[model samples]
Target: MAQRILVIGRSPGVILDAAERLRGKGFRADATNQFDDVLTDYDTATVDVVVFGGMVPPDSKRQLRDEISKVNGHVTFVQGLAGIAGLIVAQVESVTSAAGDDTGVEYDAAERTVRLTLRQPAQVVVEAWWATSFTPPEPASTSTRVVDSRFDPGEHVVPLPAEVPAVASFVTVSVGPAVHTFTVGAMPDAVRRMASTSALPPVRAVATHTYG
Candidate 1:
C-alpha cells in the first residue's frame, strides 16, 4: 500500500492540485488550506508525510510540527518548497525518501549532458524519447533508447543526442521507477543562440606585391 501524505498550503486549489499529482505518483494524498484541518479527520498515524507549501506560515509550521510530533513520532514533515508542478513532485519524492526509502534518484543537466544521482548503488535504467510536444506518440511510432547499467552511489553523466531539433521541448528521461520529462535543448537559450550565429572570416588581399 502507498503511504498517505497530507498537503498544507495557503491556497486550497494549489494544495488539491499537488495532492492529485502526488496521488498519481503512487501516494494517497489529501489537501487542506487550513493548518488545523490536516489533523481533523486523519490522525498523525494515518498521514505518513506532511508537506507544507511555499506560502505556508513559518511560525504556524514550527508550532504544528511540535504539535504533530506529540501524536505520531514517525510522521515526516517537509516545508519551503517551490510551487511549480514539476518541482513539487521532485521535492515530495525527496522528502518521502528521507523519511524511509533510500532508493531515491535525481538528475541534473549541463548542456546536452545529464547527470543522474542515486542515494545508493542500485540498478538504474534510463530511456529517452525526444519530441516537440509532451504528448507521446503510439508505441509503434515512438523510438526509445534504453541504457541498462549499474552505477555506484554517486553521480553519472549521460550524454544526449546532438541532433535534437530546436523545436523539441524536452526528452522523456526515465530513471529507475520514476520518470522526469523536460526539455534538454542542446544548451541554454543565450548560449545556444550565441553558438548559432555565424561570423564571416576576415578576407586577405594580395595587393602587397603591386606596391613593391
Candidate 2:
C-alpha cells in the first residue's frame, strides 16, 4: 500500500500544490486548510505521517500534535518545511526512514570525539557546544563541524575542540532536520576511561527529536 501523508497549511493553493507533489512521488497524499477538519478526517482515514506547511502557526501545529497523539501515537509528525518541492520530499523521506535507529550524539571520552549515527545515508552536520552551566553560560563557545563527506548508513565520529573544558555540560547533535541533546554530567571522565581501552567503545543509543 502507498504511504498515507497529510499536509496542513494556511493557504489552500499551497496545500494542494504540496499534496500533488507528494502524490507524484508515489505517496497517498491529502491536504487541508483547517485544523478542525484534520481531526475530523483522522477517524475516517489511516495516516502514516502529518506534515505542517511553513505557513501553519506553531501553536496550531502543537495543538494538532496533542490531539493526534491522543488518536494515534505511531503516526510520525514533521514540520519546518520549505516551499521547494524536492526538498520537501527529501525531508519527508529522511524522517520516515529514521525510525528505530540511534540518531544522537555520543561522547568518546578517550578520543574526545562525538559520534553521530543515523539510520540512513545523509549529508550529516553536527554542532558540539560546551560550558560550565547546565543551561550553558551566555556566549558559550560553540563549534560547528560537518562530516568530511556524506555518511552511509551507520556511525560517524567528529573530533571536538581539544580546548573543551571539563566543565562542559551539554551537547546537541543535528542530523538533517532532526536534533537531539544530551546532558554532559560525567561524560568527560567516561571518555577518559574509554580512551585507555584497547577495544573500541560500544555505540551508545541516543534519542532524537524533530523541530520545524
Clashes of 2: 3
lDDT of 1 at 124: 58
Write model 1 residue lDDT over 1-212, tens digit each, in one string.
Answer: 78777777654445656777887888877766555544554566657788776445556677778878888878888762333343455556755643343444343445555567667765555544433222111101122454577777877777655554444224444444455545443323432232123442222211111101
**Top lDDT model:** 2
lDDT: worst 10-residue window of model 1 = 203-212
Top model number, TM-score: 1
**Residue 187 accuracy (lDDT) in model 1:** 29
In the range 112-203, model 2's lDDT, one tens digit per residue, is 67787667786665444443321111112233343436778887778766555555334445565554544443334533343234453232
CA lDDT of each prediction against the hidden true structure? 0.53, 0.55
lDDT of 1 at 87: 41
TM-score of each: 0.51, 0.45
lDDT (Cα, 0-100) at 184 in candidate 1:
47
Q: List ranges where model 1 is wrong by over 4 Å.
A: 97-114, 117-174, 178-212
